[model samples]
Target chain A: MRHNLVLRVVAKLLIPFILLFALYVQFHGDFGPGGGFQAGVIIAAAIIFYGLIYGLDAARKAMPDRVVETMVACGVLIYAGVGLAGLFLGGNYLDYFVLDHDPAHGQHRGIFWVEVGVAVTVSGVMLKIFYMFASRGRDPE
Target chain B: MALTVIVLTRSRNLFTVVVLAGVYSFLMATALVALDAVDVAMTEASVGAGISTVLLLGALYLCKSEETKPVRKPWLPLAVSAAAGALLVFGTLGLPAFSDPAAPIHTHVVPRYLNDVLRETGVPNVVTAVLASYRGYDTLGETTVVFTAGIGVIALLRRRRKQPGAANKQDAAK
Candidate 1:
């Protein structure tokens, strides 16, 4: 794979667009056929593609293991935090209607943040699984 | 697609099985699209076809490419599976007909979501509105599940690299 110039070049050209498309799916979920889960998997697929072509070291360098671990926790925090915010705002748990002054606006804001949290957690989970499996039976550098 | 499934089951090569499983996922995704479930189709394509294939391939790297034959026949498992399939088919007889306006789901829950989703959530996608707003707790729980799974994998796989001389340090890291 290291000697395959065409593979390397094509991956280099494709990775960025794949990431961009993931972001698009993440944001456009409310209007389209995608959301956090799908977008997260797509993003993970892109990162995994990079790992497949360039090696696990490069992928790990791009996203450090410690940071990935933190991401896995942080996403759940964000989601629960949003629910706590709703409770504090004089509504039931995860009540998005009370998130902002205008109920509709609050709903939009809440959904957006929740979806973002989901996206982060999903991508983190996928990457963590990939890393664990990929590193198995490998000789440490 | 059925042919692919048959080939997948018959193939002894793990690599071929993984590849054929990916093909099955693509076929399922296409079927989802044909059924007008685009969101589900997208998820199936990305998670099932794209990521799972890569993950399975990574796992394959650590294992033999060929599957070992079982010592005993699989007649019991096959019979159980057939019984479960028959039970499921029988259960479907009690279900409301497809696309029936009077169905419980269509009559009770879906109408509220479809009618008030845009008004309340200010989002055009009812699915998103329902998932993120109406079912926020469920989504939160799902996120937590993902987090838990990640933690579980890390716990299971993240062995401390034993130093060449300090073999005792592995327990300390754990």
Candidate 2:
């Protein structure tokens, strides 16, 4: 992999675009046919592609094991926290209508955070699984 | 697509089978898009064809490439599979035709969601409104499920057969 100049150069050129596309899918999901889950997978795919081309160690350093592990939990916490926020805001559990004066805007705001949570957790889990598989049967640091 | 499946089942090499499965998933994603399920299509394409294939290939690296021949005749398993497939097809035969105007789904909660989603949530995509807002609890549950699965993987991998690094660290510290 280190010797393949073509593969390395092509991957370097493509990764940023792949990441940009993933972001598009994440935010544009409301108007189009994408959302948190799709975006998360796309994000993981880009990073996984990086790991494949560059090396597993490089990918792990780029997204450390501790950070990846934390992500697996943090995303869920963010989601549940949003629901708790709704409860504190005088709405029922998971209610979005009361977040703002205009219920529609509140819904948008709620959905955005929730989607962010989903994307974080999803990408975290996907990367975690990849790391686990890639690191199996190897010496650990 | 059927041809891909047939070839997949008949193939002996695990690597070929893995690649073929990815091809099968890609074709399935195409069919989903043709049915106007673009969101689901993206999911199938990315998760099914992309990530799962990569994971399978990774697993393949840890094991033999060729499958061992089974000693059994495989007749009973084939019969059971054929019976299940026939029963499933029979079950679908009683369902409404594709895109029927009066299908139970279109007449039921779907109409309400479609009519009120934009006004209620101000989201142009009804699917997003339904998945994230109207069915927020379900989506939260799904996220929790993913979290649980990830934790489970971590737990399984944490307990390694050997802890040479732990021993080495302790020795160096002492």
Candidate 3:
């Protein structure tokens, strides 16, 4: 438990950087080696690190199960909402070019929104999984 | 072959076995990256190296740390594994070279994604466009799988409620 103090501090320091990097990857995906999926996992990994050092109960208390569940639903809703937006604009599903007057900027806007949805869903799912395993059974050690 | 043989033959510690498994996962991740499947490599690294090792360690705390001696010959399992490995190699021989321009994968719907996604979808990154738009249904299914797993975990781990009468009896006894 004493040794875990260093791990806790390290996790605290590293997680913010990891989350920031994930956002960077999400936004800069057009030019680089990452995109929504990778960015999502990176953010999830950072949260998982926090859960590991702080204990599952504590982590769950910090983030809360209901909030994570809501995030998951919101992500899917956001993605579908964007597609519906395109549909409303008289284009097929997810046809972002029809989203605005300028097609190129519309695509950027669509990608940003979609990536946000993906990132939110992925992070929520990751934390949810960690909470599940950590809370399992009666062994608290 | 030699590494597997050593792993099979040695009566080593459980930590060693777990570490060896991690090494094997790392090797698999390297192979995925070499094949230019960066997405697969990332999942392999995160699931295999990060979550799996931690879970295994947690389980180890509840179980014995020593390996039990084998009661029978391991030759059959070895033969089976070798045959499976050979079949896998044979299967890979027919696969298209990584990033081959003329491969069927490149010539099919994938080409549409690579060539016209920018002009059509207006998304600069073709992969994101493909995942989020072209095959959004599949992505939706994958997200559902994650959601289902989360639900399963929560259901399995939730604290059980005490019966009203049982709680009252316990309180009376106290």
What would the TM-scores of all predictions be? 0.94, 0.95, 0.79
Off by over 4 Å in 1: B162-174
lDDT for predicted candidate 3 compared with the true structure: 0.74
Residue pair clashes in candidate 1: none
In candidate 2, stretches whose alpha carbon ends up further than 4 angstroms from where it belongs are B159-174
Predicted structure with the largest lDDT when compared to the true one: 2
Ranked candidates (DockQ, high to low): 1, 2, 3
In candidate 3, the residue pairs with backbone N, CA or C atoms under 3 Å apart (3 or more residues apart, or in different chains) clash, namely none
State the lDDT of candidate 2 residue by residue for B1-174, as single tens digits. Answer: 999999999999999999999999999999999999999999999999999999998889779999999899899999999999999999999999989989998998999999999999999999999999999999999999999999998998765556789899999999
lDDT of model 1 at residue A60? 99
- Give the top-scoring candidate (TM-score): 2
Please provide, for model 3 over B1-174, each residue's C-alpha lDDT reduced to its tens digit, 9 standing for 90 to 100.
Answer: 348447835846787777777776777888889888776786677667666676676556557888787899899999999999999999999999877889987787987788888787666667677776677767767766766766676676666756799989999999
Tens digit of lDDT per residue, candidate 3, span A1-141? 525778878888898998899888888876555666677777777776777787666677778889988876777778778889989999888777777789877777777787777777877876776666666644543
lDDT of 2 by residue, A56-110 (tens): 9999999998999998899899999989999999999999998899999999989
True-contact fraction per candidate equals: 0.92, 0.81, 0.29
Find the 10 residues in a row with the least total lDDT in model 2 chain B: B155-164
